[model samples]
Target: MQPGLKLSQKVFFLVAVPLTVQLTFVAMLGHLLDQAEKEREREGRARQIIHHVNQIHRIIIGYIAGVAGEGLIGGGSKLEQSYSLRAGFDRELPPLQALLADNPKEFAHLLRLQKKAEASAEKLKQVKRMFKHGGDLALAGELPTMKLILRDLISELEAILSEERLIERTSPKIQATQRQRVRELLLTGVILNIIISIVLVFYFNKSFTNRLAIMMDNSIRLGLGQRLNPPLSGNDELSHLDSRFRDMTGALDAAARKERAVVENAADVIFSLDDSANFTKVSPAALKMWGYDPAFLVGKHCLAIVPKVDAKKTMEALNKVKSDDANNTFESRVVRKHGEIIDIVWSVHWSEPDNLFFCVAHDITERKIAEQVIKEAEARVRQILESLPIGLMMVTLDGKIVLANKTFEEVFGFNLADIEGETIDSILVDNRS
Candidate 1:
């Protein structure tokens, strides 16, 4: 959310924050599962302790009943069965104690149960000693007392069983609590993750999407030669790109203005022609050079203004420029609006990308007249030199004969045509050599 954050930073924030939250959620779920596992283990141990205590109570009851029934039938108590059952109690005690060790209250009950069993075992030993004398009546007299002692032992075990059953009953409550906590944790984690994703997406959409759209619009506006939007805020890359784009737009605008100014004020006609040699653009100088408005001539074939005599030459120049992709300069004549024909020296360059010819036409009518005048003066000077010639010859400083009068050529028996541009030494060869 901070300003000037780079795109990568924003992405990291979006990704890393959710990952951290998810990891925390996973850790919480793991802790909940561990607690649930411990509860289940405790419940299982409680069930085992309850089962063991009930088995001990059943064994003591059977032992007392068997002894009483045998004495009623005039048979002495079986010492083997008495000792065997006592041995069974001994084996069951250790396991019950181990099962209840984790629960202090249950274990204390187990301790009381253990003391009762030891007392019951000692009384059974004394009863068995009476049985060794083989008197059925004496066995009958001791039966009720033994039954009473064994009943007390069974009562102590019942207390232990009741405590274990109570623990087992509470298991469902603990499991229900665990299930509720699981649902809450799952719902909370899911809601939190969804909210975070939505918030990050919303922020990025609000922050980036609009700016990107503006940038796209700016591109279209710049191409249309329209003003651009203001520079974007912040120092991020997108903003920096926008700043650079604006600067480029400024440069292009300046260049376009300068080109327009030059075209408007130039003395020579600067114009462009398409592939078909139609005038695509004509500068204001078309008026000064050919007495026609640029707007009137634009979109018209260039041959319309070119004199019929020079149209072939103009087409040749255009074709040469197009085929060679090079610049060409030629002298051509164009008819003005006032029925006057003027000499124009056109310098044309071909643009391959635009498939157009960019041309500059300079009026060369004065230069042509001046060249004609210089030719006439040279003829007059030669006529005067021929009339007064006394066998005269004119030579350059390099000793190459430039001219010879008619009289001089006749006397030397040499034709001026033969000796012209030749060194004088060719005619003056020495016989001594």
Candidate 2:
């Protein structure tokens, strides 16, 4: 899971879980509210039925005591009391019927109560009729039966009241149970949320920190110039970075190898000198050119190998190369390890990054010897030309007098230096010739 999920996905999951839990909790709270509303409605209906039953009982008592006059015993006449009682009965009957309809087992008990109420209502009507006929004794005689009917009705009402009271008494326990369920659900949600949070934290921390630690160790190894293992693999950003780092290191290694090959196999004596003109590095060819190991030359000043007679000139050239930031070529005599003075032609350039001068020196001893031999032969030829008795001159194809011997110059009464580059026609007797 950790490998499959990205950092952002992990964070989103963490956030979404809590929101889902909250939504579920809200749903549960809504259900609890609905249950509470139903409990309140049940309690209200039971109280209303009890109130109606109580009103009916009061009217019955008033009728039996012959105090059913307006504001006499219960605040209305007997006929008015009957109407009020009927209204009360009418209000109470539907709920009772509904209760019996819902619970048919209670129908047997309610059937007896309903018969007694009907009998009481009939007796009430009779007593009212007797009063209208002025039969006071007959009305009085029917009072006991009416009283018995009222008693039976009251008893049935008391039974219903007892059932309502029992229901009322049990309501708190039911509410308590519901409340306990809500608390349990809440506690379960909290515990589950906490457990999920803990698991996410542990997984994320372990996974992220472990991978990051591996990357950190790899970076440290790279810094120390140590070999690295295969890069971490995944589609995550860190994995991509690690792969890119691997590519960069591979490129750098190839470049270093190529540079090392060039430095090692170069024919010229390649070396670098610091700003103070001291050698920092010397290639292997120095051993062949200077008869000194390359390692022995490092840290030595450039003038250390130059002959005393050429040291001043070499220093001047070095200064020029450094100040002008340009390539310089100069030939100078250097003393080898075996105490021999050899000629070498050097090419030097200043490097800004290392604050050093990169130099390539080529051994020019044989070339210098050949040049000296050519110079001696030329001097001998000049001596022979000067020793000639007759006048002689050399002219180029372009009609210029290129050379004239001392005797020729003396004979012609003209100096060779003055007529060397002059057109042969210029010195001729006839200018056109």
Which residue pairs clash within candidate 1?
A: none
Model 2, 7-58: lDDT tens digits are 6786787788778988988798779867967776677666765665566567
**Per-residue lDDT of 30-112 in model 1, one digit per residue for the tens?**
89988888889878988888788877877777676666555555343563476356676787888987777777876777787
Give the runs in model 2 whose Cα sits over 4 Å from its true position: 2-83, 86-123, 130-198, 205-209, 234-244, 273-280, 291-335, 341-357, 431-433
lDDT against the true structure, per candidate, is 0.84, 0.77
Which residue pairs does candidate 2 place in steric collision? none
lDDT for position 288 in model 1:
82
Error of 1 at 57 (Å): 2.7
Best by TM-score: 1
Model 2 vs truth, CA RMSD:
5.5
Could you tell me how far off, in angstroms, the CA of residue 345 lies in candidate 1 after the best superposition?
Answer: 2.5
